[model samples]
Target: MTEADFAFLREYLRKRSGLSLGPEKRYLVESRLTPICRRFGIATLADLVGTLRLSREGPLERAVVEAMTTNETFFFRDRVPFDLFREVLLPKAIAARAPQRRLRIWSAAASTGQEPYSLAMMIHEAGAQLAGWQVEIVGTDLSTEVLEKARLGLYSHFEVQRGLPVQLLVKYFTQIGEQWRLNPAITGMVSFKPLNLLQPFEHLGQFDIVYCRNVLIYFDAPTKTDVLDRIAKVLTPDGAVLLGAAETVIGLTDSLVPDPQHRGLYRQTAVGRPAMTHRLAAGF
Candidate 1:
């Protein structure tokens, strides 16, 4: 790809999805978009860029943006976050919301449904603790293609093997030919939607927990702060926000602060101050 081609594609991706692609990612851009070029019968990367420049809201634009967005995910990824959920976050949320008996969790950038489904499984494991509770898990992603797969709740043998324990697999999944289908009870607990984190999230309502993990690394600092700011508005007063292991709110935004004991957990700073003393006493 030429300099002009690279620059146009990079800027287009940044504007469309907040994906900050530097000059060094030229090879990545070329590799990802080559398939799109063939699909559209374009002669070269330059041609693809020319076509994209003409129409920002065209189907080609959506294809290019989806091609550039990384959707790497699997069940129970990076175990610690889920561990924190089961042991600390979930119990605390349950206790705090016991009076209302309602709980909501949002998995931002929920690719192919594994992350949210994993949360659903955890809710199932909680059993009687959430027996009378009204629970909802919302999984949102920018890619409509992946969102459709997530809604289907079907995984190949390899997908189920990654980060999924054998006992839990047998308990929650049944084999259909070469693929495993998650039980209806687990699938019914979660809902999938198409969302762009760069856009507003007020319509999604408030949640007790928000998992926006492993996605901010692709964004510039300003975009990161903007997305975090929007998240703060929809979180319940005592809600917890979890980011990727490598992501943090420090220096990015003042809306949230890291949990003292948990590695990836964070709480909205303004509302969290009064709860800090109580959280410490509860060993959270």
Candidate 2:
């Protein structure tokens, strides 16, 4: 792609998706858009951009966003988060919300549903502890295609094997041809929806825990702040926000404060903080 074409597409994506594609990302755009160009009957990236410019409301624009959105995920992509969920977070959350009998968890940017499914498995393991508890797990993503896949709860053997513990696998997955179908009991625990981080999210309702990991690294500082601020708006003040191990809240935004005991876990510290005593008392 020419410099001018690159600049135009980059700006277009930023405006539409809140994702900043810097000069270093030029190759990424080229590699990802090449197939888009061919699929749309365009001769090159320049032609594709021209088409997009002429018809912003067309399917091509949606295709561009879908093509650009990254969907890298695996069963328990990073093991620590899952371990912490089972060992610390879930136990605390269950105890604290016991009287109220309701718990809400959101997997923001949940690609292909692995994270939410992993959470469901943990909750299932908790068994009678969570009985009569109103548990809701909502998984959202920018790409509708991936969200649909996540809702289906089906994965290829290779996909399921990556980062999945053997015992859990045998208990939760049934073989279906070349892929593994997640147990219905586990898959039914989550609800999937399409969500764009660039937009307001207060309408999604408040969450006790927000898993927005592995996504902010794709945005510019201003975009990151905007997204985090919006996240803070819907998060329970004492609720925890989990980011990727490589990501942090420091110097980026003041919407959250790191949990001293947990790596990559940040508890919302804004005014009117919700009671975390229950979670703390549970040894979470």
Candidate 3:
């Protein structure tokens, strides 16, 4: 890839998805776009960029977004958040929102849908305990292609194993050819959509629990603050927001207060104090 090709990709991705690809990730850009270049019959990355510039809204642009946004994810990528959901968050949410029996959950960076599906399975296991509950699980990603795949709820064996409990796997998934298809009951539980966090959030309603894990690290501090602020706006006043274990809202934004009991959990606080510092205990 030439400097011109790199410049095109950097600007296009930043404009379309708010993802910044630094010079060090040049290999990543080449690796991701080689097939694209081949498919378009372009001899070089620069040629592909020229073709892309001339093209309007069509499959080419969509392919670029998909290739750049594609990420590796699997069932319950992190165990602790699900554990907290079952043991503490769900119980508290269910009790607090009892009369309404309404709960909304969002997996903001939900790649291929495993996190939301895992959540739906947890709720399904609760059964009559939540018989009257109106549970809404919404999973959104920047890539529409990935969102469609997530809605299908089918996973390869390797994809199903990462952080998923053996018992739940046996109960909820059925063998189909080489892949395992999640029970429709589980896939049917979630609603998937294309949502870019870097843009202003619109149309989508608020939620009681927002899971935006492992995503902010890709963004700059200002983008993180903006995304976090937008997330806080749609969250219920007392709702909880969960980020990746290494991610924090303390110094990144002031709209959240860290939950001492829950790692990566933040309670919506009024916007004013953005410099708070925090330290996490190991294995939380």
- For 1-284, candidate 1 gives per-residue lDDT tens digits of 88987888888899889999988899999999999999989999888888888865967888999999999999999999999999999999888989989999999989999999999999999999999999999999999989999999999999999999999899999999999999999999999989999988777877789999999999999999999887876777788999998999999998898899988898887733454444435543
- Which residues of candidate 2, in runs, are more than 4 Å off? 271-284
Per-residue alpha-carbon lDDT of candidate 3 for residues 82-199, written as tens digits (9 for 90 to 100): 8889998999998899998999999999989988998999999999989977899999998887888898888888888787889998999998998988998888889998888877
Q: In order, what lDDT does every prediction score?
A: 0.90, 0.85, 0.83
Best candidate per lDDT, number? 1
Q: Indicate the TM-score of model 2.
A: 0.93
Query: What TM-score, computed on C-alpha atoms, does each candidate reach?
Result: 0.94, 0.93, 0.90
- Give me candidate 1's TM-score against the actual structure: 0.94
Model 2 CA lDDT for position 219:
88
Highest-scoring model, TM-score: 1
Clashing pairs in 1: none
lDDT score of model 1? 0.90
Q: For model 2, what is the error of residue 141's alpha carbon versus the real structure, in angstroms, after optimal superposition?
A: 0.5
